[model samples]
Target: MSLSLFDEPKLDSHCHVLDPARFPYAPDVAYRPAGQEQGTLAQYLQVMDAYGIRQSLLVGPNSGYGLDNRCLLDALQQHPDRFRGIAVVRNDTPREELQRLREAGVVGVAFNATLLGTEFYANTDPLLRHLADLDMFVQVQVEHDQLVALRPLLERNGARILIDHCGRPAPGGGLDQPGFQALLALARTGRTAVKLSGYQKFSTQPPPHADAQVFVRALLDAFTLDACFWASDWPFLKAPHRLDMGPLIRQVEQLLPDPADRARLWWETPRRWLGF
Candidate 1:
């Protein structure tokens, strides 16, 4: 079936849209996009329309606008129907400011540990507790190994956790690897969700690599459609090759061949997790 038919309820659970003119990237920021002007809310909406995406969650870009969510928040206000936001904040940020961000349609808090380093939120128990109190989800961008290391702390917090990029498991490691095992264990607790995006970022091989497929299928099987979400990871940051969001969405359709599974991955699950 064509993705157009899924128009009414489709959602991209993770994406980054920024107006570089307003929030330009820092010179030293790692993984900076080739040209800052490639993606914007307007461009993102066009892609969404083409692929029948009704709504999307705008995740804070780690490279630019570090802890300054105004750019994303503004986009959310301007296109409330088509977007929601997840923000990255300093562990020491005032509670009042965080509360204000929540009022601004910020549904979740993100820790970009892969780029910022794991110690960035090391003493973040209080922040995690605050999110739990607000009933907000916690988004983590750590590789599989890091995930395995942090599994205990994440499970103990009891806050809903969203893992980025298929756990970013090594290409040869397979799903039974220690990191993936930890992710599967977290899924069993019914408090975690994973994004089936950025396969390019995880694999050394090019598109349609069988190793990448192995990891994707493992996640789909381990978490079930209800606990999974899909994204374009649009603009494909720092990727060696350019990726079209449209084809990625189509790839997801192929991966989850069951109509019911597609419905859950593309529609039902996002609505529940992103509250759209």
Candidate 2:
């Protein structure tokens, strides 16, 4: 039998499980995710089942939790078979702690240069080296011209890297923009991968995000199908408007019309990279 779009097996390469009630938001955070921005593990699982997602790569957000990875760890421990995680940690965090996180099902650490700015991660070389030694990924979220500043640091470490949100390209920044071009250039490095997601974060147009398609095509051509993965930035943090998973799934169908290509981007690539 042929499969429907939602019925096709998928691994959500990006999403979050925020249980402020159980884990509590950090006191120092400038903004706390409330209401729909929050999606607990139980809730996320229901969404997964609803959408035919086999697993998810849970990312720890810096907004409400800061360095507190307890919520993410709790979810990973509780549902070890269903999810892996990307964490948020301080630059000075010790190797021992990273090892502990690795043992706990964390696959990488996130560097949110978009939310915190490139300057904040200037001292991350040691951390990057630690990740390289550990064979873990350095997942980055940077926007606009920010990537130009961090390219040297990211390339030198040789840690396997995952980029978030199509580099969160700056609005009207076209194909030749320095930051997006920098992202495409990373494709030559062979150790890099990008989450083909977050159109709402970067696109000037809504939903179908027609303008962002060019960037997607450029990335697919640059990184090749094997190195690209599909992601829905679920319960999308700091979003300017409400969004739903259904439309995102439909968007993927439109993005890659061929069943064979969708199979690679949606399931095969992530399964190989994350061992799902």
Candidate 3:
């Protein structure tokens, strides 16, 4: 049987598109690419079409692009029908600039603390309040341990949170660890969601790491399908080893085997959360 592109409605809840030629990595950054490279919207669209994805949430890449969301914003404009974006901005980014981004279809502001450090947004209530006023969700990429430190502030502001990569908890730490526990507690409030992606980054084992599965299953059980999202975490940033996106998708398929559950993770949930 031929595989049809529209086998299901798919919304890739996370990924990045960068144009290296236009925006090269800063030399001062801790990690630099081994080689000059570029990945574009056209390249990602082909992957999406092949994988039956109708839409995607394009996040700004941290390693190379820093706070410049131009490449990501440009992609969203080019394929407004198929892409929505989340951007990374400094805490002091102007309100008018943010409004312009909102007009360009950015639904959330990403705090890539995992790569840039949690202190980047520390004590920046003015910025947080601005985002809240704009009604934009805050997508955080902090390590699981960092969640505990952030909980009170997040709760106080009633910020809608999207925790990236299953909170990036230590694989050996287990669910009882403060970070995972904090995440579970946050989920209960109905104000937070977690992305079941980038498990490989936290595990030493191979793809579909059993250690990672423990966390993935726990998140699936904690968050309603509406509060959960999944992604390939394509190009698998800073992995100790390489990973193929195909197997990653299959792993998500395995985790969500029921058709309705699959539909929620693959489509509905992301549409509701990301507003794409």
Candidate maximizing TM-score = 2
Q: What is the lDDT of candidate 1?
A: 0.78
**TM-score for each prediction?**
0.92, 0.98, 0.92
Q: Rate the local accuracy (lDDT) of all candidates.
A: 0.78, 0.90, 0.78
Clashing pairs in 2: none
Native-referenced Cα lDDT, model 3: 0.78
Better of 1 and 2 by TM-score: 2
Instruction: State in Å the error of residue 77, model 3.
Output: 0.9
Model 3 per-residue lDDT tens digits across residues 47-140:
8877888898888877677777778888988889888888988778777877889889997788876766767667767666777788777888
**Pairing residues by index, what is the TM-score of model 2?**
0.98
Worst 10 residues of 3 by lDDT: 29-38
Off by over 4 Å in 3: 1-6, 26-28, 34-38
Candidate 1 per-residue C-alpha lDDT over 60-150 given as tens digits, one digit per residue, 9 for 90 to 100:
9876667667779888899877787899888876667778888888888898777776766678887777777777878988875778767
Q: How far off is residue 228 in model 3, in Å?
A: 0.5
TM-score quality measure for candidate 1: 0.92
